[model samples]
Target: MSGHGFHVHGPHDHELEHAQAGEHGGEHGEHSGMINQIALFTAIIATIGAIFGYMGGATQANAGLYKNNAAIRKTEASNQWNFFQAKSTKQSLAELARDLAPEDKKSGYQAKIDRYEKEKNDIKVVADKMELDAMHWEKQSDEQMHQHHRWAQSTTVLQICIALAAISLLTKKKWLEYAMFAAGGVGIIVGVLAALHI
Candidate 1:
């Protein structure tokens, strides 16, 4: 009869070693899971933030452009009204000068003519200034709209990159990481180029 269950002397401590290795592997798996969770959470937050940022900037730019357009219209209307008033005043002065007797009209007629001319000149200066100001504001509004559009496009690309990076962490996909990095880098470059007028 075999004293040790019909087996020759086996390698000692083999089962114990296997148990230790299994424990270590479990710990490693748990740590990896934790890391993946953190990565995913961060990416989600970044995506949400990018969306809100893009929305806010776009809204503000559009509102400002609308307000500027309204102001430009108001300035144009005011200038036209000023010109009309000056013309009407000059026509009235001419009629009054014609009604006066010839002997008495000479001095009064000269005074009235000078007054109407000065008033017309003043109104013309105001109209010119208003027109210049309106043009400047319109240019500024256009620039702001362009800037907002660029930012929105860049943000959308960044959001996509963040999502890809999160997936890479979960799956341990090296190619996905590379793709995310490339996309993010391209977006940043394009945004900078647009900003610098390139």
Candidate 2:
């Protein structure tokens, strides 16, 4: 009543509204199958795209992690080598000192030996921990890559079923059409996410 377009309709308006409603209702029922088909097709494409993207990412991460593990192993080996070299040099110096001095030199030479031992032990511990960390990441990356492959396989099966069901709905099968529409909705959600990189 407050709007400029507002008007009180007579009997003619009531008859026209009823006719239009019936027409639209029948048309909607007929077009439901077509709509479901389009939706299901879109979803299948999205699922495929998502699977590819996830697999590609997994492959890249796996390769990178493998390289990282190799580098970490090499570095650990280098640290171990350096530790042994230093230890040997310290022992030779202590031996020389003992040879050139008298009995009083034993106490001071023992301290230098202890210090070198501590340094070597600390280096070994740190290198071991780094190697462990690298191994953990490499394992995790492999598991994730395998998971992506599994998901891709499962989605392919589901996509095939949905596409076939959508086709079946076109033959005046009302129940199948409704089922297809419902299934297609699930596909769309998964497909759109994969397609859009969500």
Candidate 3:
């Protein structure tokens, strides 16, 4: 029999079947119970691991999106700064013209210089605000990347737990079962930390 793409009869399947059919009724019942428990535990852990893996991927995507936003903001700020520089250059030229021009033209050049100054101030404000926005986006990207790592760590731990569960089933080792549960617990704790953005 097969379910969810996995064959029901694994390497130890025959051994378990023999144990279940043996004359030792009490031992057979206990073995069946252990199998059931392990099967249930594996199912639960696999589901949780899948969720953690999805979360990791989502956080990674968010980090990339946020980083892209930061870059765009930085580029916008740079453009603004370049515009401000152009205004400054124009202002300087106007100042030079004001110094050399006739008395009537001097007032016109001075007005141009004043207008450039005001435009530069406005551009500076916008550029500064864009820079701050870029910084904020960068910070958000860093935070999302950190959370992604936590989710990845949690998923890895849960995968290990699943491996331990398989080994315990194959070897009938109680210690391995306990270790599996411990790993599962640690994986869950890490998932919680990721959720909390810790």
The C-alpha TM-scores of every prediction are 0.61, 0.49, 0.87
Best by TM-score: 3
The per-residue C-alpha lDDT of model 2 at residue 4 equals 89
Q: Whole-model lDDT for model 1 versus the true structure?
A: 0.66
lDDT string for model 3 (1-198, tens) is 887997767768988777767546666667677888999999999999999999999999999999999999999999999999999999999999999999989999999999999999999999999999999999999999999999999999999999999999999999999999999999999999999999
Candidate 1: tens digits of C-alpha lDDT, residues 111-194: 777677677777777776777677777666666666666666666677777777778777877688777777777666656644
Ranking by TM-score: 3, 1, 2
**Candidate 1, residue 69: lDDT:** 76
- Local distance difference test, each candidate: 0.66, 0.63, 0.96
Candidate 3 Cα misplacement greater than 4 A, ranges:
1-25
Writing each residue's lDDT as its tens digit, candidate 2 over 1-198 gives: 236878787899877786676567765544664665656665765665466556656655765777677677767767776876788688779767867778798778877877877777877777677777667766755665564454454456456546646566556565765565565555445544444444
